[model samples]
Target: MDTDEQQAYRQLALSGATPMEIAQVAHLHGLGAIEIIRLLRSIFTLEFIEAKELATQAVYGMSLSDYQEKYLLPLFQEFEREGATAQDELLQSGDDRHL
Candidate 1:
């Protein structure tokens, strides 16, 4: 990293800035925003992004998991409750009406 970037990131960490926050600043300041966020979060989380590519990925859309414990599973459970059988979920959505 350049001297300026190193200094800025150190300050960001010391200030207890979040990944999302640092990301916004980097964008406003025309710095590599996404990289900053990824680096910061990776320091504290399991996520990772190469330092050089971090900035671009931050501005780009995030790839979300189709499976989430909170929403996806719960919603599926509710669907099960609503007569969405495991067998049914195994099939296409519109197949139920035909069945």
Candidate 2:
């Protein structure tokens, strides 16, 4: 997705647009509906994860650096590593067929 699509998606999503509505707007912009859905899923997933972490920090009095070092950094690294592994597996499996 392009920057404009990202901005529009975030704005519409944060403003409480429905999934179908978001899909319509995204489709009008030549973006795929499935792509919009995936983007929304990713956005909300990150928000959910961050909210849980923030709540934990509030309960434990964890410092920003502590949170980063203990949770955020490791989680991000693991996600990246997992994505890379999945990509490698896909490549090795020769799964070029589109879903």
Candidate 3:
């Protein structure tokens, strides 16, 4: 049930007309200005979404906390139960026994 206005708007849009151009075409075809603006708004929204997806794909990395959790947290936890002095003494004793 597409009307003449809808067909005119679609043809103008598919030809990549600028917003002003589309409005002019709509005016010549006896459509309201608001109707042309509404169609342009939906097209802009779709383009924005597509550009955002491409940007996300182009760059990827972990946040600082993610890096710390993966690499630093385990090492810290292992030595955390033993105070610094105790850990150093244990290492020194092990070295002496090895010698």
Candidate 4:
């Protein structure tokens, strides 16, 4: 970012704009929207982004260590058991992949 763009970011920051809003403006100006969102997220002391409108941008392909260490691991375990049960049933039905 140039001095002018940095000033724009600073102004947006001081105005207390949400991360998503900042990202939209940054996108319009051809800025790095992801970095802008991350910067604002830090400024706002966010744990997880709740902007459903930006859910794809908020967490798409995101592999935050905390998310896996806490939320996803537990959810994965729950689904793993269900998958195991389904696999057993499919095996009884003679799945060719197992053969």
The most accurate candidate by TM-score is 1
How well is each residue in 52-73 modelled by candidate 3, as lDDT tens digits? 3322222223333555587789
Query: What's every prediction's RMSD, in angstroms?
Result: 9.5, 15.6, 17.1, 8.4
Looking at model 3, which ten-residue stretch has the lowest summed lDDT? 51-60
- Alpha-carbon lDDT, every model: 0.56, 0.61, 0.52, 0.60
Model 1 ranges off by over 4 Å:
32-46, 49-99
Candidate 1 achieves a global lDDT of 0.56
Model 3 stretches astray by more than 4 angstroms: 1-8, 46-99
Stronger candidate by lDDT (3 vs 4): 4
Query: Per-residue lDDT for 30-50 in model 2, tens only?
Result: 654345545556555545444
Model 1, C-alpha of 48: deviation from truth (Å): 2.1
TM-score of 1: 0.37
Model 2 pairs whose backbones collide: none
Off by over 4 Å in 2: 45-99
Indicate whether candidate 2 or candidate 3 has the larger TM-score.
2
Compare candidates 1 and 2 on TM-score and give the better one: 1
**Model 4 TM:** 0.36
Show the colliding residue pairs in model 4: none
Per-residue alpha-carbon lDDT of candidate 1 for residues 2-81, written as tens digits (9 for 90 to 100)? 66775776588678976565665666666555456555554445355433234444454342242245457888889878
Tens-place lDDT per residue, model 4, 6-43, is 67766886898766666567666654535555545544
Point out the worst 10-residue segment of candidate 2 by lDDT: 51-60
Clashes of each: 3, 0, 0, 0
Please report the candidate that would top lDDT against the real structure: 2
